[model samples]
Target chain A: MNARNCLEVLRKIKDVAFATVDEVGKPQVRIIDVMLVEGERLYFCTSRGKDFYQQLERDGNVAVTALTPEFQMVRLNGRARRLANQKEWIDRIFEENPSMNDVYPGESRYVLEPFVIDCGNVEFFDLGVTPISRESFPVGGGEVSEKGFVISDACIGCGKCLRGCPQQCIEEGTPFRIMQEHCLHCGRCFEECPVQAILRR
Target chain B: MNARNCLEVLRKIKDVAFATVDEVGKPQVRIIDVMLVEGERLYFCTSRGKDFYQQLERDGNVAVTALTPEFQMVRLNGRARRLANQKEWIDRIFEENPSMNDVYPGESRYVLEPFVIDCGNVEFFDLGVTPISRESFPVGGGEVSEKGFVISDACIGCGKCLRGCPQQCIEEGTPFRIMQEHCLHCGRCFEECPVQAILRR
Candidate 1:
């Protein structure tokens, strides 16, 4: 529903896929813990001695995704920064997550660094719903990315996009309208457009 | 330990994170169903009109990851091809996965096409273990990528890398051996090496 709520859902899921690009431009992903979620900010930690850490340190850009048992999915893509107060943040993370102590006992926990993701886009998609609802928004003053397709004003109202849509989310209007919340963003409509009125943004 | 077994584990998990790069080179991920797994191959379906389908059509590159309840994770990064026998594959898929019928009933199922990943790298990582564990291999005669860091034989045996390793999987040997199975590929050892004996491939 909201960025904070979506982050909370991710934190609840705890173990989610954290994806980053390797040095060779190959996508690398691993299951990571979402240690904490505070307001619009989310926190996580990885051992500084791990490849996951190196990738994060070098790239900073990250995409995290988790799906709940209820079929609700939350995706967050943005940049994460290693916290300045390493020890303080790591200690706080450990205190909140006691299970981590078993992995890194005592002072050795410092080997792990904490990172924060406070700005980015958050998309919530629910497959449990009939129409398959979706909502995406930017948090922390981040710019919203123009993803999927946008029908331009050049529309002749041919209704080709409506017919090609899998979800039947398009409706008749002056230039026809796309119900984005229920749209699949499949680009089928974009491809089926006769006059190139549907543009990818 | 093998690609087939790892893919079976993913199939057991069913709902896993499927990662792909978008048109602009940003990571996009979602919870995708592993509809079928036969031999060393894996299969899944997406609506022809979806961005996910488009991404796969343009670029066959994909990374799929799933973690079991026991903390065992399977990662498969490979290229998927659209099958020529779409209808036959879809019907077989539906027979194996009946629930898909609910999502796309009757003739609407034709909108969904099947893709298979038969060749690529598969890595099995188990976090439930005490020291953690990992094994990676190529499947379907695919070339194994040189991922992570490898320590060369220019060993001074300074023990810095061993001390710097978070998993303590390094040992005293001719080259100060790193147990690849337990190595985090974190680059800490590479950074700690004074002679730059460690190399990343």
Candidate 2:
């Protein structure tokens, strides 16, 4: 899909999942009500001087994920800058959500930051079957694993390792199941398991 | 920054924080290495079939934050998808990481997915600046607190709250310190504090 079409799909979706790293190298995740996407960038509002804001200040590069029940999803990567002082800009953002006015009177504690990903660099992928998908284009890195990832004794059911899996192969419950059909063997789940329950089969 | 440049920056950054929610409406946070960035999309491999992935499938809107010492940071909002059975696309993604050859070889237990955000919907901000910003248009949000947030008696000091604080205002030492200068009043520290110690005064 072209950038415009891809963006339209993203904007229509409401719920999103965002991923980022902290100074300590640990993955921190959160769910946001407002995700403002514009131009070659992604934008949002949150309390200023918060850990997430602090992290954003220290690092501009980031990844964003948005999902919808229509089986639509969007992920974007870019650099973020905080608008700790742009009232006019902040006001424009708050206008989108009247509810924000009830909570943050002046957006004082709020920060209006925009994450710009070079649209020119953006790679687009649409689920389902599409005649125009460049799915054949080499993705990025090397193969993760051909075989299914091994689940060690450390499986905690906390469900943290689930995000690392792409093929929807890792199952929860007593013993997490690795569906062979969906498994991509990326090893991301294995590496991210808090207890090291997953290993190479 | 261009997508390539943004990717380069993301690659160099060591830690990133990922945010997601469970069925119960509670937020979960973690850190991970940003696997890849495509166009306006960002990709990370997760074990298919896990709760996180399931959650992503059900709800994709998410918030991500990255922190740095240089006081530069990036926060993102977007969506995520699960690569059902696109071997060709997954293969392309795998080609980007040469290290996979040494670790997981030929194995493909992962899924390939991407996210894209609307350009016109994006907003930008900066810390130590005017506190808010948007496009060259007019906005209408109120200001957050400036006297600094409040730390209630519910202090647990799990130090978990500090993870979400951008100002590093909620210090985890002996007794946490809320630095007013850095505090943006995002109240994330307060919202995430397990004991509910932090608050907006």
Candidate 3:
């Protein structure tokens, strides 16, 4: 659907996985709560004393994703900005997430800091359906990433790639076409092509 | 526990999240199957034609993680080597994951290639317990990564870190001690130190 809807889905799956690069540039990931979602931004929080918090402060870049029981997945690659009004944000977060009160308790909650991810590309992928399905949109003026494969002019139109496609998302043409929404980006066709035509964009 | 045990947890989780750095250096992640785990290596597969395959081929580094519903987590960061015995490995993977037959059928399964993470750091974290708990081990001669913060000799042992620690993992000592196993690796203690003696490794 749209960016907001995708984020809403992630919010619904509150316990989502967040990945960030450590100081040494190694990717680190953990399960984090989606504290709140409003407008185009998704919010979450971590304690100031943890490496996760330091990682966020040092490298604002973060990737978040969650797959629902129905095989619906929402992936967001974006910037995590610490909100300015910490108290107000934390208060609102606690109000929305009452269970948090049990962990932080009253004044101790201040140790946690809130962050928002509003600018990035959001992708929705559903594996439950036949041929799969996917869509992407940008949030807060961010650019949608051009991922996956596309057939180039080098196509011999031999239909080799089409036959190998697990999703059967390739359409025959002078150069052939990959149905973006239904494609798995599995690269099965890229290798099957007699002519090196399928290119990743 | 041990590295093998951590990988076993991931294998049990099966649908784990894998993170990789794309060509642009941004983090990209998805739910991938943890096809098999024997001894010190964890196995998985992706079609050779996808960007994921290309990224792995180009970088060889990957991060794998999954959180169980009970709040236990397994995190692995390591080198992913494209196994030499591709056909044999793929066959083993398919045999271990019979449901795959429904998707690929027969010969089409050949498109998927097997990769193994035999060298890496494995971490086991259990959040379900009070004060939390964590441990790290190396896989296949890989070095165990030194992560988290360490209280240096400069520590005045003011106990500020201990008091502020959410997990109460910091113990008072000449330099104050952060019990690595119970430490959240959250930087609260690092920020609480007035003398700024805490150092992240």
Candidate 4:
């Protein structure tokens, strides 16, 4: 479809997969509720005290995947940050999603809830870039499971999967080790490897 | 309709009403091309040194409305920000709409083209604040010019419309003025307004 058409499709979807990298160069992925999208700015509220926020502060770069149940996918690569600790910001989010109020009671507690949106929360790491449309995204072919068989040698010294591993079954030594029993078979490590070092056996 | 079904309906539409503010406290509204939507993020590109980006940066808050030719409406509110300026970022956008490359050649010159998206661009800006919904957004309001209109009171003195204005009809003053004659009536100012003070006259 056209560019406007692509946006229309995106405005309809809700869930997004947010991927982040930590100081140690480990990747973490989480399925988050998208709060809003304007222009190229994508906004979400997360706990500033959480690892995600911490990782963001360290490295604002991030990738967000927007997929429709019908198989339409758009991958957005941008940056994120914490906007404000003001009560007005917290109240705005609470007003939009009152259910959040149940999770956070007082304004003091609310400020602690991470009511940050992109307005001031984040800025684009790349200032002179345009937004990509859905058709151009690397047309992902298959869905990778959470866990996969690991193969050594291809490791680039970047420990992405090791950190993404939900069970922490993968170990990082000279070559790294995978505690097979501790592995939940999510295979996320295999899927996220930049060099495809982790093989599904 | 269910959210999924709602998206399906949203996919069939074109032409969105965007509301933003100009520099002199005037509200501007218009319909512009929506590049793509992934999750809550709606991607679009404007000139690097444009009024739209200036106002957007000043205030990330914005409202976007898209209506289907078949009488469906989708409204979103979120914070806007420029995406990172990088080759990969620009390439991704070009991948989607190759035609953009024609307008913007790949190079530092293209850096003047700014990619923007809104993360806080949430749906239901007035869901709890006022009373609005899928029906109230004027889905079938046919033939209404998708032009930008800006009122003076809310204008933040950003002066964005002067350059992008096809007719060069925008005038900046104590309260920004739009020369109705030279105006193409393509309400970019209204849609780009950070504040909602702009409305159809």
**Local lDDT at B118 for model 3:** 93
Candidate 2 wrongly placed segments (more than 4 Å)? A33-35, A83-85, A106-123, A130-201, B1-201
Ten-residue region with minimum lDDT total, candidate 1 chain B: B101-110
Give the best candidate by DockQ: 3
Model 1 lDDT tens row, B1-201: 788899999999999988877777767788889999998899999987677887889878888998999999898998888999999999999999997765665666777889999999899988898788998878776766656777788889899888867678888988788888986666677777899998875
Candidate 1 lDDT by residue in tens digits, A104-133: 766667777899999889999988877778
* Model 3 ranges off by over 4 Å: A152-157, B152-158, B172-175
- For candidate 4, the per-residue lDDT at B8 reads 33
Chain B vs. true chain B: TM-score per candidate: 0.95, 0.51, 0.96, 0.50
Clash count for each candidate, listed in order shown: 5, 148, 8, 75
Best by TM-score: 3
Local accuracy of candidate 4 as per-residue lDDT tens digits, B1-201: 432233233334423444454444333333334655554345665543334545566765444554443323454434556677646556666677676554344442243333444333122111221112222222122121222354667766677645444445568875677765344334555555566555555
What TM-score, to 2 decimals, does candidate 1 have? Answer: 0.88
Candidate DockQ scores, in order:
0.46, 0.09, 0.52, 0.01
lDDT at residue A107 of model 1 (Cα atoms): 65
Candidate lDDT scores, in order, read 0.84, 0.48, 0.85, 0.46
Candidate 3 residue B70 Cα shift, in angstroms, is 0.5
Of candidates 4 and 1, the better by DockQ: 1
Q: Which digits, one per residue and each the tens of the lDDT, describe model 2 over residues A86-143? A: 6655676677766555434542334444333332223243332221122111112212
Best by lDDT: 3
Off by over 4 Å in 4: A1-201, B1-15, B106-109, B112-118, B121-201
Q: Residues A1-201, candidate 3, lDDT per residue (tens digit)?
A: 899999999899788888887766666788889998888999999988667788889868888888888888788999999999999999999999998765565566788899999899998999877868999999987999778889999998899988888778899998899999998777778778887898877
